[model samples]
Target: MTTSNGSSGLFISFEGIDGSGKSTQARMLAQALEQDGRDVVLTREPGGSPGAEEIRALVLQGDPDRWSAETELLLFTAARRDHLERTIRPALAAGKVVICDRFADSTRMYQGLSRGDLRAKVDALHELMIGQEPDVTLLFDMDPAAGLARAKSRATVEERFEDFGVGLQEKMRAGFLALSQEFAARFEVINAARGIEDIAADVLARIKARLP
Candidate 1:
């Protein structure tokens, strides 16, 4: 179930609040695995594939209130479906490590808990449309205030979520921690408020231990 249609490749997903350094760690993990002679396919949700990438612009670059919570959920699910079809599944089928920056967990947090109580809806959509879960999900936990500061400093068009402010980040951080407990088997909570190299080393080791 974790490897997509029973494929042999490892599926690893990085999850955290905005600016928590999960993206950097995901990339570094991919590079480290490749350096170790492993076939690695590093991708991300919302914009992993061509179709999803299009949806990404529509959802991520607009005003925070541009789309209703339910509408945003549908859009994200559509993008994830495309991503799975065009990027994740094929790579896993080819026996390559699929490292994703974010996955359904983010949706489960952002849309499921952010605006309102939509976790049930998010879960229903996921079970019906996208059934696969990552073999391991590294949760980069950090202070919400610090993370929000780092996120706003990025100055990227994807600031829609960041624009929600620190209050949302605080709520999101708690939501993500709860998720880690809910999906404890695949979730590894990492303190992300540290040096990049140190965090990368820890992530690499944790992932290697879970690799088949």
Candidate 2:
């Protein structure tokens, strides 16, 4: 997890299955960095900026049959563009530590696993929109079955992806692992099958070691 400019400012993203504890860890990491006197901007994909939030609702709440795989990919990219332009990129340029709960990787994994051809289009759009990548990405590696169980136990309502069958979730988990390997230098896989504090501690240690 090396940084190009020695981490005076950093952009970190969290990726994982539905219940992989990314949001919790992302918040904890951001708070820890803030305590260390680093300016931190905590945000999430699909619902960061105002425009993106609207798209998020449509994507997560609207009828899945209304959207094709290609449409789903485009909608995710649309939200991402808004998020990057309005929230992420600005914070990074201002020398703030940007910790995003999810980013482009989620789209790649979900859409890649579900829609084969759409994956390539999403990748191309990602390159066009988010020209600069995250300095570090923490991947919460956990079994899809366990993650789904945890997610269902925690949530009263299921989002569109949450409603996806176990098989798709398993495939998405595999996609994440494969993507992590492909970007080994920038992506760190964290064992997320532990207590929250334990996971947070490990994540903190990883970030501290990577940051200048």
Candidate 3:
């Protein structure tokens, strides 16, 4: 990943549909790494830094139709800018593994699908704005319907994206898998249908393979 104040540490991103258990796996990975005596920073997109957190509430709280896809992209990019500047870059420079819950892939799928066909625009904007990518990405691949059911069981105000229902989630799952093909060098597809410990073990193995 390229940056003005670039980091020497590995940048890992966890990606999947809302209920793919990526978040849990990310947390588990972080804990496992720390247990292995490595420095790790656990963070999430659209809300990693204070400014980004503010942006997060604004973009995620209201109706799913609250902002146009273009507007939402702008907001998400703004938040990501803040996160990279204040949180991610520093951690990387300090030789800490930065585990991000969601990265640009989320934008590629969510906005690209929600507001009609915006994949080209998403790619263009990411290259223009956020040119870097994770050193390794763990994609929790699973059935969208199962993931949606897991997501629906959660209690939170951030249901804007979740409200898209199973159909949209199916589309999103496909989008993420397609992305794995595009960036096959960095993506490790994990089976999320299994138990948490098993998934976490696979993630740790993939990460350990990359950690010098």
Strongest candidate by lDDT: 1
Candidate 3 vs. truth: CA RMSD?
2.2
TM-score of candidate 1 versus the correct structure, residues matched by position:
0.97
Stronger candidate by TM-score (1 vs 2): 1
Q: Could you give candidate 2's per-residue lDDT for residues 1-212 as a string of tens digits?
A: 33553335788999999888898999999899999999999998888999999898877775546577778888888898989889987776677888988888888887755656567777788888766678889999998999988887775443677777678778888889998989998999999999999999999999988775
What lDDT does model 3 reach? 0.87
Error of 2 at 156 (Å): 4.7
lDDT (Cα, 0-100) at 82 in candidate 2 = 89
For all predicted structures, in order, the TM-scores are 0.97, 0.93, 0.95
| Deviation (Å) of 177 in candidate 2 | 0.6
Q: Tens digits of per-residue lDDT for model 1 on 1-212?
A: 34434888998899999999999898899889999999999999888999999999999987899999899999999999999999998988888899999999999999999877999999999999999999899999999999999989989989999999999999999999999999899999999999999999999999889887
Sort by TM-score, best first: what order? 1, 3, 2
Model 3 clashing residue pairs (backbone): none
